[model samples]
Each structure stands twice: as C-alpha cells, then as structure tokens.
Target: MALAVCVLFDARTERRIRELWARLESRGVHTLATHTHGRHHPHLSYAVLREWDLEAVHQAVDRLPDGGPFTLTCQGTLAFPRGRAALAPSLTAELARRQESVVAAVRATGADLHRNYAEGAWVPHVSLATRAPGALLPVVVAAVADVLPMPLVVNRAALVDSGTGETVVLPRIP
Candidate 1:
C-alpha cells in the first residue's frame, strides 16, 4: 500500500466540501461519493503515500511554525488523470506551507518520497467522487447543482492516520 501525509480539514470546512459536492452534483457534474460506495472524507492532503513516515511527519508538523487558518476557494470540477475526481483549487499560502512542513518532516525520516501533491498541480479541494459510483451519476448531478462557487473557510488542519484504512478523525491543530 502507499503511504501519504495528508491534512484533514476541520468539520466546518468539511461542510463546505459537502455543499460544493451537492451544488456541483445538482448541476450535472457526476460526483465521486454517492450513497452506497464512496467513503472517502472531504479534506485536503499533502500527498498520497507512496511511503509514509508517520513519526517523522508528526515531528515535522510539530516543528512547522504555526500557520493559522486561511480561506481557500473552489472554482469548478475536475478529474485527475491519476484516477481521482472532485472539486478543489490551489491552497492558500498558509495551507501550502503547512503541507510542505509535513513533507519536510517525512523526508527527515529517510523514507522515499513518492509524490509531492502540494506543488503547482495540487488543487486544494473537497473530493466528491472517486472510484465509479456506477449508476448513481445522474442522481449525484442533481444534488449539487446550485453551489458551484462556495467560499469555504478553513479554520484548522489535522494529521489523520489510517484506521484500518478506514476514514477516521484524529487530533486537529490550529
């Protein structure tokens, strides 16, 4: 499996992600998460783990000079050629620095870095879909149509560890 160091946004921010999904889905953009299969949560991540150094990441995060909350905007929908599908935009400077600090921490552990998703191609977003939701595409489109340009306030960030590879909440940082 791949190891990734990711930051889970606080709940208030998560709600905006869901709202965007709903708005986009309502507008005919097929979503990644549907009622039956998609369980991936709404959050921004630094990188998808090719190799993860949990301890190092935690340490790096601890060392990162605190970057307070910053607002990020979601413009539209996009599909990653790498098999992900969702809505997101470039992260704010604060978010990017925080993400980089985590990466730096992971690198300190001597684990091979797989990918740096925080770079230019990294679009900070709340993913609404990934893996085919099959026949529910149309339904998804109808659910999120109106809220395309929702401005979400990111109040906090967290280092979420995999809980048996299931979505789990961990301690958050300000």
Candidate 2:
C-alpha cells in the first residue's frame, strides 16, 4: 500500500533516542508498548510514496548518490499529515541533499510521491512520537522541551515499510 524511507540509527545511537522517548513516556507524554502492528521507533523519515514497490523503493535508495555525514539539531516539535508528533530540526545541507535524492530516485519508480514532503515538508527530524494519542502531545512536547536541541547524526538512510516489518539499507554515498 504505502512505504516510507527513513534513516536507521546505529544501535548505540538509537538507544539514546529511545532513552529520550522513555523519559517522555515516564512523564506521561508519549505512547509506549504500541498495540499497532507498527511498533514505534526513533527515525528520521526521508520520504513516503503513494504507490510503492518495496523492491523498487530499495533500488531507488540504493542508487542514490551519498552526500550525508551531517548532524541535525532538534529545535522544536510539530504535528503533521495526521496526528504524527515529530521533533523539528534545523536543516542541514547534507540532510537535505540525501532527502532530495531519495524523493527523486523514488519518483523514478513511477509512484506519485507526496509533493508536500518533496517540495517543502521535509522537516529533518528524529521522531519524538507518531500517531500520538491526542491527549499526550502537549505533555510530550513539554517533556522534550527540557531536552530541546537534541542532535541526531545522519550517516545512513533506509527504505522501509510503515505497516509491515521491512527495511532495506542503502549505503551512504560519502
């Protein structure tokens, strides 16, 4: 149905993101132990496609020219497309370069990618939460506020399915 491409953080790095999320959870500000098939995880989303062929998406990302090796600093929070809660980061050239490449490469698959993200919606974030419980957004934001300006490194990106458990690692072009 739909597919999303994201940057998978290293185990150690992801742990920190999880730790921050856990802190938010403790404050009763974010969802934990998700019931949905898609369990929550920390990630920087690159793009989403309307019509996705997982294999093609992988190939597209795989072929993307690498220009990463950047750090994104989270400055605030944002809600989008739906109830998705996200941490907004100050844009970095490398992040934008890699993101743009993924969008363009995926479009070559002939899928109509969301223009909002392709043109201007790329926020360059390390997800704080997604599909948030309407009640917890404010708390989550406040919890994260104490830790605002968390910086995440972007070294590699991947092609993944949001619903099904699937991921394809694309080598960084650096």
TM-score of 1: 0.67
Candidate 1 ranges with C-alpha deviation above 4 Å? 19-39, 116-121, 132-145, 162-174
Judge candidate 1 at residue 58 and give its lDDT: 59
For each candidate in the order shown, give its overall lDDT on alpha carbons. 0.56, 0.69
Question: Tens digits of per-residue lDDT for model 2 on 49-83?
Answer: 87777777777677766766666778888776555
Query: Could you give candidate 1's per-residue lDDT for residues 41-139 as a string of tens digits?
Result: 566676555565666665655666655656666666555553345655655677666666666666777756655463455556566765434454444
lDDT of 2 at 21: 71
Give each model a TM-score: 0.67, 0.82
Clashing pairs in 2: 66-173
- Model 2 bad stretches (over 4 Å): 30-35, 131-135
